[model samples]
Target: MQIKHQVVTRTPLGGFTLVEVLASVALISIVAAYFVHIQIQQVQERVVEALAQDVLTLANASMTYFSQTNEWPDQENGDCDDLIATLGGLGAFPVAVGGYQGPDGITLATRCEDTGDLGRTLLISVNFPFGADDQAQMLMSYLPTSVNEDVDDDEGPVVTHYVATPRRASERYRFYRIALEERGIFRLSKPDCPGRRNDPAHILLPQAICMPASAQGLGGYFFDEIDDDDDYWELQLLVADGEENNNVSDFMEFSGIPTCDGNRVYVGAITYCETR
Candidate 1:
């Protein structure tokens, strides 16, 4: 018998060559690049969605605050700083409908009536990348969700703003009023709207329907806004009647509050306030 020693050798587990390794890496890089592109697109989409929602949220908050205190939120309060508390922070808006951009462009220009108790004015405007421009609609009913009840001091009869319906290149405006139960009691409940369910009226003051037209001062009303704190206003389409004809004519169109097509847009605004 003879003892035999066998020589052992190891072969690499993978049969792949250098070329195969390089090809595999190229494929992986392609896949990775595609994934990165998708991520970027998603981020941009989310930003836009957030902005739209922000517009609606602020609008409703202003409306609700108006209903409770009968006064618009103070433009000077920490809660009232445009774009700072928001993504746009003044520039948050693409365009200034009621806000300012100045010669360069003013965003959110507020006017205080000198009376002190009268409260400061607020004006904001934005443009969707696509939508009808400067059209008119009325806010027959609304639901806003924020306010500061601690601050009280009845300045005037109610909270007022201007909205303008469509008219010639110029000359269109309407007055909008938000009547509050009291000037400093923020109500968490679904607004007092005493007659909304059946009476079929604006929640604020009784009667005094918001209509559309452009005339002189006083009884003559229209829809228009050259700048923040501009004069006049118009009617927002009523969810009940056909005044609005919304058809993608409002800021809330994407939010689904109310439309001529019978949809809802979370967005709301003060389009018309009665003259008296």
Candidate 2:
């Protein structure tokens, strides 16, 4: 057997090419970026949802306080800090109820007043801090139409800085009183109104215009304009009814005022009401 020298072809151990390494790195970076984007979006959604729920919860708490104490949690000029103080400081109100200190990048504007029709009215407006345009828009989506419609139509981006008070009975009374004081008229032309018609009875006019004989000031009367609509005035009477039992005919009686359609009353002009 001739011992033939077997030439062992020694192939050098191969390493990854620069292009392949770069491609792998690029793929990993893309996957990481995608996951990060998803996480960011989820975080944002959770933040806004929590914010919306907190706002509703605070409003409800304020209403409950008003219902029980015939007063609001904070004063007319109260802001978020004032609310925190009014609610017995942190770990109270929102914190106690929802485990939330309040929405980030937002402020609170609250007013409590004695609306003649609605016993004790509370107005809570959520305001976005300056330079929080994104947060404002996000909040607008969650806000009710009552607040969203207030956004200026001839605006750049509908800078919805203010959110109207909820349409609950306690809140609507505040809004109704504010409209009368500022606009000298309270017209529920929004679809939420029962008839959506500008009836003199439904269309609350200043006492001067409708009831010249009644007290000159915007007193505890719902309608001054007298018309053939007995039904409308009847509804107003329910509001003016002092007897607690007669005030709310139905549990859903809106602000103790009767409505033809029983829809949520919307008064667009009244942004807020100051305490008396």
Candidate 3:
């Protein structure tokens, strides 16, 4: 019995080394970091969507106010807190929109005016504060294609320094107009028009040039800024009915021609001049 007891022995269990433990920790950290990045991106996307919704809300409210009052909520500069308060008072919001607000951190300044017979028009300018370039680009994508094009082209949209902060290269004020009523037709010079001043029958001549006009003094009319150099406008004549010719020479002689192709025109720079 003494001899059997003396012969008994055992081996120790195996465990991970320090390097293996460190490797496991590194792997976990990487996975955690990846998930965190995804979460941050999702958050950014939501933030952009929320901001866009806020703009849409403000636009709808302003339109409502206009429809009810037959006048737009006055916004001289870009800061629209006063306009917001006015809208809130008119019951534009279910819950009162309080505090100074304008599409997340971006500043909004608008210029509303009665464009004579063009009806009332609202020019909402989106100013991206410093350090908001990425956000501005994202916001632009969310805006209407017409607005996005205006901002992208840089030739259109009167750039105003309503926001005092210095802007980044990518950051700029974006503009879009909301027409509350039907646009009024602008009377072209007698030499440019195809029909006589008193006659209505010759209004739609085959090679006539004409356009819907806005008030001369108001911004966002035919051009955002009608300067001295751009005083005399040269527009392309409209193509006559049943005519297959698309040549520029044929229509070049007409004074009423306004558009470059179908949507834009040159006014110091290429700007939008959508035909009515």
Largest lDDT belongs to which candidate? 2
Residue 217 in candidate 1, Cα distance off native in Å: 43
Per-residue alpha-carbon lDDT of candidate 2 for residues 197-274, written as tens digits (9 for 90 to 100): 212222332222222233334233333332333332222221232323332342121233223344323333232222
The lDDT values for all models are 0.32, 0.44, 0.43
* Shift of residue 208 alpha carbon in model 1, Å: 27
> Model 2 off-target regions past 4 Å?
1-14, 69-105, 112-123, 129-132, 145-276
Clashing residue pairs in all predictions, respectively, total 47, 0, 8
C-alpha RMSD (angstroms) for model 1: 24.4
TM-score of each: 0.26, 0.40, 0.41
Higher-scoring candidate on TM-score, 1 or 3: 3
lDDT of 1 by residue, 122-162 (tens): 33333222221111011111213212122134321111232
Worst 10 residues of 2 by lDDT: 190-199
Worst 10 residues of 3 by lDDT: 193-202
Model 3's TM-score against the true structure = 0.41
For residues 5-89, could you state the per-residue lDDT of candidate 3 as single tens digits? Answer: 5665788789999999999999999999999999987887788787667666767777665544434565434334366566666
Candidate 3 stretches with Cα past 4 Å from truth are: 1-12, 68-70, 75-82, 94-98, 102-106, 113-121, 126-129, 145-276
